[model samples]
Target: MSSSELVRVGIQIICEHLIEVLKEELKRSRKNYREDVDVGGLDPLEDPESYRNHLRMSENQFEELYEKVKSKIEKQNTIMREALPSRLKLQITLRYLATGDTYGTLEALYRVPRCSIGRFVPEVCKAIWEVLEEYIKVSRTNLLNNIYLVHSLT
Candidate 1:
């Protein structure tokens, strides 16, 4: 083979080796930094009273709400990692709403990254609102109708 051809082949091999080394380094870095905190195992249902205090609602109420909104908020797992469970998403959102805690506080408590918590909280809240909006509207309508009737009688 020509010297130029041999030199090109050598450069290509070096580039491939560097790429593999970079990939391995990335995997090692991710392993070192990833907080593999098992947030799933921390089930609030185990202590109902504490759960209620934390989220400002009973476990049964939380389950009912989860049933209604699960379809909207639940996500499928991807190859890189398992998706955060729908129940966890709801709990995080509720805790944030109940306590007005910052995402950093939540990250420490829940072992979720602050960025993930911030991204998912709004989405979970929207799902909850969508599920509950009909009940809210109906309740408001009934309240207004009762008020009008009482005013007319007076």
Candidate 2:
């Protein structure tokens, strides 16, 4: 074969290997999302009230927060490939906050890898904070005035 043809063949082989690796990764992610015992066993949709114990949010509150933060937390499938569902992302974050659990513990509960859990927790938290910023942020005037008063007293 010509040198150029050999190079093409080499590229093709590399592409095939990458494709196989991506396919396997996708399969494992899909399995983790679908068949994870904790994900299935928790069944937040089936018993949202019971889920409250774990997430510290009632069904209505969870839905409200989910809707508010959905745009921020939602991931495009093309880039994220096996993106966690918005609901699942919120659940995992809330569970972490409620329980003060490590990512390792969350990995066992949510079946997402600890590395992914680490990323998702922060992403979801930032999204939630953004969604609630209007309600959560203190008035700068009030905050500054209080600080000034405290400093003056000191």
Candidate 3:
């Protein structure tokens, strides 16, 4: 081969090796930051009032909702990383709904990437709605009745 051809081949091999190394470094760094952060330290579930204020629901309510939707929203762990827990997924979704916080804010607070939060929020919300659609319709009817009764009394 010509010397120019040999040099080009050597550069291509080096570029391929560098890309592999960078991929490994990226994977290692990702594992270090997100999944390693101790979300349990926040422990919002430990305080019933705080949990209600933050998530707009009591712990019992959260648990009931979680139980109903867990099968749909729960993810399996994989070789690359552990899946976010079903309870955490529900909590995050509820917090988002309660606060209307941006995904960037949630990522900072929750130690989950905004991209993952964006992806999971819709999935969890769908699961919750699927599980609770009938309950919500009934609650709406009851609420309308209560409003009418109050107006009648006044």
Candidate 4:
């Protein structure tokens, strides 16, 4: 393959690897949901009746993210079919990662255990962080840079 194609392939693999890592990280959390779980209601999306907010650039940005993630998800699904054996596992996991729903709500919405969602979310988030750790780290350099910038502006 060409260098550009290799880069594209590497990016694709990184995304798939990120999702897998996130799922594994989610598995390491030990929290369980009890009947008294105290999650609040949804902070509703700010789209208005007249669709003004929907017309914003953020919507298009989100749409692009959705497409990229969805394609990566599809590729991962094919690779994982033999191992996972259940088609819904990935979809449910993605929903848990993308949407900050409580275990109870996810259970009701996706027919999975509240305990499962509670246990899974952090794992996935950790995995994503792990994949991008070098790039995403809150480094001393970044903090110092930000501090300097703030002081200069003030």
lDDT by candidate, in order shown: 0.77, 0.73, 0.74, 0.46
Best by lDDT: 1
Candidate 3 CA-lDDT value: 0.74
Residue pairs with clashing backbones, model 2: none
Shift in Å, residue 109, candidate 1: 1.7
Model 2: per-residue Cα lDDT over 1-154, one tens digit each: 9999999999999999999999999877866654443442257778777888888878788889989999998886643255678888888878876777777777777777777666666677667766777886776467547534532332
Q: Please provide, for model 1 over 6-42, each residue's C-alpha lDDT reduced to its tens digit, 9 standing for 90 to 100.
A: 9999999999999999999977766654355477324
> How many clashes would you count in candidate 3?
0
* RMSD in order of candidates: 9.1, 8.6, 8.4, 20.8
- lDDT-wise, the better of 2 and 3 is 3
Ranking by TM-score: 1, 3, 2, 4
| Model 4, span 1-154: residue lDDT tens | 9999999999999999999998877654422322234432221165433222322235444344334444333323232222121223334444544554455666776665566555444443344344446767687467547534532332
- TM-scores vs. true structure, each candidate: 0.66, 0.61, 0.63, 0.30
List residue ranges in candidate 4 displaced over 4 A.
1-94, 137-154
lDDT (tens digit, per residue) of candidate 3 on 5-116: 9999999999999999999998888676545566531365477677778888877777788889999998997656678887877777787777777777877778777787
